[model samples]
Target: MSLFFKNYKPNTSIYNRQVLWRCNSTTATQNTEDEEEFRVLDILKKRDRQQKRVVRRIEVQPDRTTKMKPDQNWGNVWPGPRSFHPASVPLPLRQGYVPKGQAPPGKYANAELMKIPNFLHLTPPVIKTQCEAIKKFCTEWPKLLNSEEAIEKHYPVEIITSDYCHGSPSIRNPLARIVTLRIKLSSLNLDQHARDKFLRIVGDRYNETTDLVTLTADRCPVRKQNLDYVNYLLTASYHEAWTYEDWETEKTEQDMEYYNWDNNASKRSLVDWYLKVNNDDRSLTEEEYKAFDISVIPHGVEYKDAVYSLMNDGESDATIKNYATAVRKLLGLPVKVDRDV
Candidate 1:
């Protein structure tokens, strides 16, 4: 019985060791492939050394204190990974949050991480046909601009003017005309809302209230991870509104999902609705709520009813005024600047 137990234990231990060895082998293989791909990227970048672009330099240290010899011109090798892929790095590293003692890993773990630089620059991969046309335009620009027939044909989107300090009359003049002969989005499978936005950008319609771009409110920052999903396209000066009624309905639905219903299940009072709109996911405590001005501004086109309700409930006029100011600031409208005498 003793002999059988010893034999069984050794066999079980050997099997466990075999499994561990296999796992290590698989991981090593993956790491080697990753390194080889990095090497290939270095080679491709070296080929494009003459292209006008930004170059990154990475310093390597053998350890925490010992300095690795400076390899200033390592045959034009691209900076390994981190400098190339900021977003691919874990959120902690991207946000500059490192644990007390751990060294940060390189931002990008693989070649797929190359998409990050494109995201940061807001540049998409160029279409092959468009690239070919750009090449042709660059090579024969002078003749094309001078041709009366070509001028009459007219391109869709053209550079009306630019400060070209260095090149031929076609390129160097501040008023050199370069037009995009290619139409990009006409072929895209865009939704109606996006299509309308495109038209507005190209100035195809009247009464367009939308701006092509807007700076986000600093108080409510956009998610760093989701920024890659943002639309990065050429917008017309004015065409049409991007959001249709259906889109607004959908937006309302999303907002409702975050709202909390009371235990009583009574119709949510105006006070409750007002409070929800005024604050984000978090809420002020009862004391904080007491400090808030529940009053509405009578002068504004909307919310006069709410202000009157708060005042009727005995909220101070000074508190209401301060609340109005806070509301404006929250909405990203400019705050009135005060000068002290």
Candidate 2:
């Protein structure tokens, strides 16, 4: 029985050792499979990295304006009106509401500077080019209008008007309807009667110092209408001045604004006094008057001019002394000499 039991135990132990060996072999196989799977995954990851495109970071260059040549045509760069662009202009422009003593912000990203209109497109070269392009459409200036006097003589009337442009929605300007017509009073061919009538008709529209007649017309709604209205007013005024009336003939010296020496009673009285003082007959023949040569009389023309000035222009101390001297000369009176007593 002892021998049988010992043999059974040995068989059992052998069975146990076989099971342990199997378990160990299975674990080793699992570890080897895991390591092969890890190697495959690593190969796939390396292949994916190799297939991807190479991404190299490239640095962009600075603005072209920074490298602009001095001799480049600026007009071609900026040909028309546009908002200011700091990157496009090579100028050292800066704008900002900075504190006192501090430098203004750089032009880059400056909202205040970009908000306003820029005249950089209207440089001297651009202006010259534009002028040359449009010059072909312009008419030659008239040779007759070379001098100021010639221009005034040819174009007696001057018409003035205004034009305006803005960014507002409405393009019409109220001031554009106003038309001013200016002319010189001396330019009108009128005699004394017509000139006096014109002065009376025009009233305060005439400037005494400049002798300019200005007529402003804004009653009409349009510029052309106002211009036409002013022209009609001017024509009517000129015709009215030329027209003669019966009452005008009866206008006396008191009614006249200026004195007329030729038509005055003083002239007739002076002639009569001179004839009486010289003991000459009023019925003398032209030959006899020629023989006397009355024009040679001292202070004849000067006395008339002085008297006319005294009556028309307000009398002064100088005029009074001139009148006394003329009277003394005309009357052939002797001058009183100052004697030492």
Candidate 3:
């Protein structure tokens, strides 16, 4: 080693640089090999941890409907209205809009079945059970009100409403909220003026033939509100009909709906003419004519009926003939005349 050292005449700068380079390369290579070994060990440790792990298993509960017997009382099971559930119902209900040829989808997870209202709660058995449960709360019908006429007479106002059931998402119907009230006009016990006013106020709502007045109110959103509104309308109209307006007293003969010989100018004219004929130039003055009673005359009743029938019923052949006959008889002429005059 001494002889080799002596023989090695070192190139000081170049030799030192080469030694430094080799040492750095060796240190880098060692560091790389250590990193690779740690990485491989970490991978093996992860694999070992995964293999040692245990997966948990959970027990599942079965559907309640699966245990239900076929003969079980359905009224008890479905007591009232509720949303549709697939697992709870046993029947194979199929529904859904699909292509024309393809069959309808099954009830399982079907949106169509869930969307619409169902009548499961209103089955015959359920209805009967419900009726029996509430039977004790209801009162017995009165024996006197046996017939429709009797019932109508006792209960004058009849309010009507409707309920609907259809294949719809919502059970509520717009038309069902509408209310109708019906009552006979005579039931109100109105006087002549009040009756005429009431008829006018009701207009087309009053049925002249049947003497029934119908009131309908549907502006409200609910049935109760509509019913109350209709009742209010009927009450208001009845009260208003009784209230006499100043303008109504001024209604003239031309404005009259029907002819009445008792209050008409024709009665005064007929009385004056009859008096003049009987007493020779002794005729009725305006004041005496106003106070005159047509019944004191012989042909007053016959003349009144004929004139009323003529004017009230229009100029028909029968009315004209009756009027002519009454006029001739009142003046002591033959009723059946040969000439046109």
Candidate 4:
């Protein structure tokens, strides 16, 4: 019985160690089980992490805009046309579309501020400074050309052009390439025939009211080319006006666009009629009539003017009335009353 009791004691010690190991494993697995419910304390711990946030420090720096001097060189700050920068610009500019009650957005980080055009760079002082810088390259204008008349005398051909400025991708404007040339008709050394022909050739381009001929050229791609084209057009028209055409000889006195009192058949008829009535012998030779002055007679000047207005300007009420008056004066008859001539 003593031998059996000693072997059972060693087996009991081994069984005790095995039972402790099993208890530890079961406790460790109890919290990780599928059936385990979450506690209130664990739920609070998860939510508390999201709630606890550190307060951030805002380090505000001083802006340097208040330090600008009244006479500061603005060209150095803004050299040319550019987008608006909030901190750089000193003015308190506001822009943007907002609700009727709401005010416009301020300059700070404003998209509207950048979109609006500002001429801050073109301030008077900046413009004066720029002009002074480039003044060394400019020469004094001639004293002789002080008056507009003197300028026109020396420069008969006045060429006009245009310039445009805007925020476009391309700097060129199509209308700016067009060139206009203007000159007084009297400025050209044209005779009576040439002047008449020039007026006819240019058509509506010549302003009879101002005696100014205007020519515009825009067919070319560039301004310089259009300028040259206008100049060429004026020269071609002037030269062509002076040259007589062979077909022009076919044009009769009646076919002439202009009327000349001295060169018409009416003047010869008047001379012959006067000589037949006044002279015992007709002294109406071509040389004698050519030497004779039409205005020497009593109402001959009035008659010539009436005939001139009738032929040049088509017959109007006033022209017909004037013609009848002059005819009555030449015949020494009393004036008619109350009826339209």
Best by lDDT: 4
Better of 1 and 4 by TM-score: 4
Model 2, residue 220: displacement in angstroms?
4.5
lDDT of each: 0.42, 0.82, 0.84, 0.86
Tens digits of per-residue lDDT for model 3, 1-341? 99999898867999999999999999999999988884345776678778555888898777658988988988777777787888778888999888999999987889888877788889888888789999999999899999998988889998888899776767789999999999999899797678877888889999878988999988999999999899889989889988977887898877877775666789777876777777757665767776787777888888889998887678998899888898888888976965775
How do the residues 30-89 of candidate 2 rate in per-residue lDDT, one tens digit apiece?
998988884336776678778668999999989879788999999888989888888789
Using alpha carbons, what is the TM-score of model 1? Answer: 0.17
Task: Give the candidate number with the greatest TM-score.
Answer: 4
lDDT of 4 at 238: 94
- C-alpha TM-scores of all predictions: 0.17, 0.60, 0.62, 0.64
Task: Provide the lDDT at 16 for model 3.
Answer: 91
Residue-by-residue lDDT tens digits, candidate 1, 258-279? 2221211211233445566667
Residue runs of model 2 more than 4 Å from their true location after superposition:
1-64, 94-116, 162-167, 171-178, 218-222, 249-254, 270-280, 283-306, 317-341
Off-target runs (Cα >4 Å) in candidate 3 are 1-43, 51-70, 164-173, 250-252, 265-341
Per-residue lDDT of candidate 4, residues 143-175 (tens digit) = 999999998899989989999776667879899
